[model samples]
Target: MLNQANHDTDDAAPLDMLEAYFAAHGWEHSRSDEEIVASVKGSWTTYELRALWREEDGVLQLLAFPDIKVTDDRRAGVYEAIGLVNEQLWLGHFELWSSSGTLLYRHAALVDGGEEAELSLSAAELIVDSAVDECERFYPVFQFVLWGGKSPKEALAAALIETQGEA
Candidate 1:
């Protein structure tokens, strides 16, 4: 559920509200008519976040790209890793751009009342935060596959190992 505090009640566009949210958080972002691109630093890497609002479909899509680039040789392993990682995610799924071999997290939300409804600021925050959190959590798995030469299952297992107490 979205918080009601910053609900859009005026003529402000959804992306406009999102721009304000990004500004309030001091996130470096640029906004156009329907899209906003922001840079957010995660635990493992800096992520490029792109948000696109489609007014006709009442859908807002968010994509987070990690700093790592997948080469042709690593594509197969990365694809398998993405499947394993996506299975454990609830909000968004990881995708590899076939042409560029770039990995990204993608998620979409629908405005309840179609054209009559607006996306809340809290909702936007939730989407962005969730993507970053998931990226941070699973970043190591991709590395394991690409750099460590580990299988998808092995990479997932290694990344999921829980550590106890403070280091």
Candidate 2:
């Protein structure tokens, strides 16, 4: 008879399972005792995603950063656009580092109450997929704000356009 106490220790830690999942998917990644770092290439941004296990918070957070450096003059417009962009996001929201002008998207998947023990590779894949999708969809808006000098409304409008034609 297998004791529940014994079974608990024998199970792989949630973070370990996540690392293995990334490896099996052929994603370039490295793991530490605290977090997993991976790079995902998107349509407009190559994101450096950090997966952190917030034990106290009972959630696994994936943060993806686009490589756009906002300059001093464009901070107001960028902040304004992010405010509007975040309002429409379903899963995660974009954030800007005011001190460094770095833009990042953050999403969390809850794994509380021993949920991590049963975490599946498919679930991990889906979380990462969502992060990548958000990055791809919004990178152009950042470009439009910083480079194209578009207003918050215009930048978002241009970014949210749907295309249905052959390349």
Candidate 3:
């Protein structure tokens, strides 16, 4: 049962760390199961939902099972992996909170022409509100955007991987 009562102020450090790791090792979103499910329903077939991606070092790391969706922003569908020209991009999307969480406050090349579409501030705000509500009573959230455009890994890594002065 996927409840909507969890997801709040997420840990910025770890998420950033993960982003860096992913940057060094490229990771991305997988394709849609909808196409296959379109023809069948209730028929149990073993399928793994993953983001078929390659590592920065040119190594292919196939994570068998992954969590990807297009539901409400707070419901984990917020982080979507769409394809654009010559690259796979992670949506400038989010999973934030009422108080605080992972809201792409300032988008820097957040969109990659075709891969990432423009998500209005209104929509972004909605995601923050909903995610905050989800984890309001529980604990803070844990967000991690794996990939995006060119040098996406590096930029994300820089954002997350803490420095001396900045947290």
Candidate 4:
């Protein structure tokens, strides 16, 4: 029997557990046996992320591909700057898809030791939210590298500086 209280579905499968979690939060989503895909609109771009339920590893892998794809000439610069950005992020990391030159954000959450019902909402929330937030926050740094001809260090510096309210 499944714990109906924690999950929206009557069954307690891993995929159902995740689907129910997202649905509870009123997030628009689609799910299959292997993965759940959700669309999130970030500050700079709209992205679609997929969360795959890895039953064998007891991991939920989440990934988001940003709208901007690096051109052939700028791949080296984008690749270098992403390393700097990845260093600062606590959860999830950005990478350029080598074949397509598309920027992607990736993360994973572990749920191996415990039962599916033990999976808290916050864990799922953290994985997805962090990916979305990072995508929105660092997108411009990549743009600066591509268009402005800014060095990785310079772009990163500008991205990290906080702005104050107008006097």
Clashes of each: 0, 0, 10, 0
lDDT by residue (1-167, candidate 2, tens digit) is 22224233443455765666566556789888779998767777578889898777677888988887888889899899899889988888999898898888998888755545445555676777788888888888888988887888999999999999979
| Local distance difference test, each candidate | 0.85, 0.78, 0.25, 0.78
Worst ten-residue run, lDDT, model 1? 1-10
Per-model TM values vs. the true structure: 0.89, 0.84, 0.17, 0.83
- Which pairs of residues have clashing backbones in candidate 2? none
lDDT (tens digit, per residue) of candidate 1 on 1-167: 33445544533456876777777777899988779999987779889999998888888899999988999988989999999899999998999999888899999988755565566666767888898899999999999999998999999999999999997
Q: What is the lDDT of residue 9 in candidate 3?
A: 24
As a whole number from 0 to 100, the lDDT of residue 157 in candidate 2 is 99
> How close to the true structure is residue 14 of candidate 2, measured as C-alpha lDDT?
58
**RMSD (Cα, Å) of candidate 1?**
2.8
Cα misplacement distance, residue 4 of candidate 3 (Å)? 28
Pairs that collide, model 1? none
TM-score-sorted candidate list, best first: 1, 2, 4, 3
The number of the candidate with the highest TM-score is 1
| lDDT head-to-head 1 vs 3, winner | 1
